[model samples]
Target chain A: MEYMIKNKNEQLTNWVNEYSDKLYSWAFYKTSKKEVAEDLVQETFLSAFKSFDNFKFESQPQTWLFKILNNKIIDYYRLLARNIEQVTDDEFLSKKTTDALFNNSGQWVSAPINSQWEEQEHLLDNVDFTTVLTNCIKKLPQNWRIAIESKYQEEKKATDICKELDITSSNYWQMIHRAKLQLKICIEKNWIIK
Target chain B: MRFFKLSCKKATEMVEKEKINGLSFIDKLRLKLHLSVCKACRGYEKQSTLIDDFFLKTSASDIDNIKIEENPKLKETIINRLDNES
Candidate 1:
């Protein structure tokens, strides 16, 4: 029994060496933070090592590892969502600047300020535009960021995202709407004007 | 006109809802009418779709191309944690 455990440990170590970079890259890509990504990768390996006996070995270790990592990412976002729910309110969705987009009668206050965006083809292909857009996304409130990331990065169903985040479906859509509004305004300010 | 008319705010919400959850028939019609007259909301729709497509396309393939610099110590750290666990 002891010998079996040791053998499993060695196998896990080999996997750690072989797949850590790939896993780390993926986690970083998902989270956009190095420390969080590293911690998640470490947790994934630890969890995998603990469950070594349960791994059927029919699937590649890489697949199993990624499945664990994906769950960790989801849990991380879920936690962020919960924390935001407790700490904040719907004010994030109804910022004064966003309110300024419309008049009291709910009519647009100005002409389309983003007409400049329409002129630019393949905006993401421009490295500077991509950089500015990335910064704009980062500037969103944490919950809004999670909302956008869960929708886009994870490609999750709206209902599933609401369940995972413990938010109502209405709240989920509202956050996505507000996040997109903020992103559009940010891009216009940072990229279009500059 | 008020019955068929949708506020720009409500129209924009419907626009977002169209992407998230398809709107009801009346709601769709109302938003369509609003956008027909509201150039600003039309701009909002175009920009919103652009941002959505940007994320959708990038999330599909951008990560594979991004090279996140590897941490040489990450392996050592995981191995040490495993050792501590056992």
Candidate 2:
């Protein structure tokens, strides 16, 4: 029993050495906060260690570790949203104003802002532009960042995200809407218009 | 009354909704009707789709190369915590 336990410890230590930096990088990107990111990465390793037996080895260790880390990030985002919810009654008022993308008579309040994305796909080849987008995404409010990341980056379903985050469907959609709008404006101002 | 038709606000919301969930047949028709007359909303729809595509492409491997600054002691701290738990 001691030998088996020792072997498991050895393997876990190797995993910590091999994957911790990559996992921490991904978490830090998602959270944009150093301490929070570190804590999430630590929680991910601890969880992975606890569930070592359940890991059937069908997937790469990196994949399994990332899956656990993604859940931790999602839970962290949900916690942030919950805490933010407690202090912001105007959240609903702000949501209603998200519709202000258009005017009272149903016309766009301004010209279409997304006009210059013709070279956007090519921007993917430009590493600096990609970093700019990441920075822009990180600037979003926590819940909006969570909504956008889960929907587009993580490719999760609306129902699943809503349930996991304990958010109403209406609020989820609002967050996505607000996130995309803000991202478009930010990218346009910082990248395209620049 | 123009009450039955989709407004620009409603049309854009439907466009975002279509990204998350499929639009209903009537909602689709409403969106189509709105898009037919509104060039800006069409621009919004196209851009929204582009943003989704950008996100997917970005996620494919962005972290592989990001040089995130690391705390040298974090791994040891985590392993120590795990050992304590066990």
Candidate 3:
């Protein structure tokens, strides 16, 4: 038992030495601040080390690290906006999104801007996507982040996220409203080719 | 062009609730009009989505500049600590 602990400690340190920089960069994508990202990455490693004994190797270690990092990012946001006033009150299920990005009216309640796409739109050429995305997400209002993460990551229904956040169905829609606009503004400001 | 000529804020709400019924008929007509001419809006929509897609792609392998500090002394320090603990 003692020998196993010693070996595990050595392995854990090895993992950090090899993975810290990469983990740090990934964290930067979420926080958009170097210091905050580094702190989260280091904390991720520390947490992993503390719980090394329970790691059953069912999945890759990176997967494990990411789950921890995701939780940490959410926690950071929760702290950043603790004083915010929420308007929604539903407990579970979202007000919409049962259909898809496009709704049934086919009229699009929130019409997506349709434009002619160029050939280069699909290119993912080892670009610094992380930096670009992190900068954009950071500019998002706290409500936008809350809405996107709940819908996209947590897979919670809109109603439920609204309930948990104390926002209304209307407020929930409004938050998404503002978020998409900001995202469009951010993209125009940062990504479009001249 | 998409229907739902929602305002930036209203558009975002529409997108969030994933709703389609609340938009005015004129709103839909205008969105279609805009999409027909704007290349940039198309790009903007793609970018809006990348925020979510990026999260899924950014596993540990997506990290950059990860290299172990190759100092022999660090290895020796570990060995010493191991020796002492035993």
Best by lDDT: 1
Off by over 4 Å in 1: A54-58, A86-94, A112-116
DockQ of 3: 0.14
Docking class of 3: incorrect
RMSD (Å) of each candidate, 1 decimal: 3.1, 3.6, 10.1
Better of 1 and 3 by lDDT: 1
Per-residue CA lDDT of model 2 for B1-86, tens digit only, reads 26448777678878887766667787788888889988777877876777676788766655677886666689889889878866
**Clash pairs (backbone) in predicted model 1:** none
List of chain B TM-scores, one per candidate: 0.80, 0.83, 0.34
Q: Write the per-residue lDDT of candidate 3 for residues A1-194, one digit (tens) a residue.
A: 98887787777667666655556666665566777876676667667766877777887787787778777876665554344345333211222331233445433334333322223454344365346556776656555565655444344443554555553456556555555555544444565442
Q: How good is the docking of model 1, by CAPRI class? A: medium
Best by DockQ: 1
Model 1, range B1-86, lDDT digits (tens) per residue?
77998888888888877777778898888888889988778878888888877788777774448785677799999999898888
Single out the weakest 10-residue window by summed lDDT for candidate 1 chain A.
A85-94
Summarize candidate 2's per-residue lDDT along A1-194 as a digit string, tens digits.
89877877888888888899889988887777899989999999888888889887677999899999988887777776554444244444444455565677766677545456533456666777667677877777655666677664355765565666666666666567777767666666677533
Least accurate 10 contiguous residues by lDDT in model 1 chain B: B62-71
The TM-score measured for candidate 3 stands at 0.49
Best by TM-score: 1
